[model samples]
Target: MKQFWDFGMEQAKSCIFPVVIFLSLAITKVIHLSLIARYDLILIICLVTQVLMVVTKRETWDEVKVICVFHLIGLALELYKTHMGSWAYPEEAWTKISGVPLYSGFMYASVASYMCQAWRRFDITLGNWPSTWVVCALSAGIYFNFYTDHFIYDFRWVLKVATLIIFHRTVVYFTVNDRTYKMPVALSFVLIGFFIWVAENIATFFSAWQYPNQEQGWHLVGIGKMSSWLLLVIVSFMIVATLKHVKGKMKQAPKLKTEKTSF
Candidate 1:
């Protein structure tokens, strides 16, 4: 127990900056800030964490660089939309402003990238295929972007979602890594996704959180949660396929088995 506690303490040391900054901000104010200001903490931590990550894991820099760039690209795209006022962060995090919070977008991605890699490594070393599936599934599902209240008339997000669903898979098929689009990963992503849906319904119903565009026919638990999830699965597979093709790895593709396995 003492050894366990010591290891935890070391882990905490690694996250000191993020922990302190986020806690201070959380205490100072959670809502009411403009999007940019609200996310100042996030931005600060991301920059700091990125620095620390390089300092500690100098060897894995190549792998880190890939995801970091991918994530940053996504952030830039979001920034463009936010700047155009196509979508606004109506809920202020205790600061006053309109665009999406800066820290939220950038830092969250940093943390998520690290977490997914850690989770992936963990699975590869011990749990074999199941662990990898869990990591990929959960990561992809969250990024699937279905619950974005796509029907919200404010930004025509619904239209964007529709357009993406129709065309995004093609983009993914050309962009993401090849070893990614498979049944184990897809199923894991699907199950966790439904779990999240179930959780969100509970939250919305209880008023713990609000879904502003609940009136949309796609909300499932609002309109089409299942359909949205299906779209997500397709996109994730496409992303993996595209990535594989880009690396000239599609020539020898492995089949994704959907059969039930006995543990």
Candidate 2:
């Protein structure tokens, strides 16, 4: 029994990323209708796994702090947007957009755990100069509002394949950078999420886009969601900050012997 437990842990440690992917896919499927129902269990499993691993690590304080910033920022932004009627998801997941349930935080963390791992493997860095824009543009191209809100839930099969490919490549490219200051990078993900939040609100305001059943997602304050657009640039700066910190650390050299000789 102990050996079996050890084996399981080893496998989990060795291939947690693949496990996360498998978990998200398995979670996203829930046929009988409700958004959180049938689909919520997968989120639990994914988060439980990350929690176990994160607890085992000693240096998680900074990471947790950054994630908390994301959570607060997300909640505030969502509450602000809830006033606008810009976008919505199945209300089953939330009693109020202003008060998104706690599970939402866990959901973000679960996906974020996988993203941190992927970014490390991709070697993608703000240090790459203009290449950083490529990541954002590509993410927008693939994760377009229309597809995730409508297509993935119903016509999931089509999305499954494309997502698998794109997500795999994205993880690979981003995870390539070994010298990473994790907190900033994680915050960038949160910032990106915020950008998406604002973007959806804008589209809905213009009547350029709308989701079929969701009513719990899009919300901004009296200001148009466009007001939050600057967050995207902030996110980019955060990424660059992480790159600069990591690069500086790497370039720091150990002290060498220096002596004053006596005659």
Candidate 3:
């Protein structure tokens, strides 16, 4: 049906950046290049794709900026995680900083790119959105928890509960074939997190990065990562929402009197 085809097209459009990155990783594995060389190729591919997205008008300048910001944020986390022995790049690369590859940042950037494209392509909008300050506070807490969990208790469950409460009434509206559809904001976050977990498995299978266990050989990434991904999705969502100016309602200032007030 036309509706089905339209839905598929919208989804594909949103996924274009992620698909390209994964395919590049696959090709890198097949070619059996050196670790540094593979990372170099991936970095080049990501840069080219970003340029092309802008040149082709597939992404606006603002969207590109948001994606770049995601890269920085992701790279910061990568540096800390790699340093803490959370995971590692098994090969050497000139672009590496403390065992983390520069290309690794693009992996996070791809998520932001997908979100930006999906928002525009699907005509997505948010309703009953939670206060931006509340979301930001939760996001910051979740991010810090990633680093603090080793030294202290992880309140991931508490954060998750708070996330649900904040987003419980929020709805995401999108269009397919000119017909609008709606879904719960929390459900969408969980779904995206699930898919990102699946992709993480595939990325690890290709040896993009290795866990402590995967140092010997490939294996499935732990299911527990889904919770982390869920938190990250919220972070990414907040960034995109801020950029797109879809944070609940925008209040217009009241009009002033046309004539000047008497002294």
Task: Give lDDT tens digits, candidate 3, residues 99-159.
Answer: 8989999999999999988888877877777777887788889888888998999889998
Error of 2 at 24 (Å): 4.5
Which candidate has the highest TM-score of all? 3
User: What TM-score would every model get versus the actual structure?
Assistant: 0.43, 0.39, 0.91
Residue range 1-263, candidate 1, lDDT tens digits = 65346534544443443354455455434454443543454455557766776687621565455546455544564565556544344434432234545543443343334333433332211111223344345445445443344443332345335434433322111111222222233444445456446643643343222344642322436435555544443444334434434554434323323222111
Q: Residue 14: error of model 1 in Å?
A: 13
Best by lDDT: 3
> Of the pair 2 and 3, which is ahead by lDDT?
3
Per candidate, the number of residue pairs that clash is: 27, 25, 0
Off by over 4 Å in 2: 1-28, 31-43, 56-59, 93-99, 106-263
Better of 1 and 2 by lDDT: 1
Candidate 2 TM-score, true structure as reference:
0.39
Candidate 1: deviation at residue 152, Å?
Answer: 15
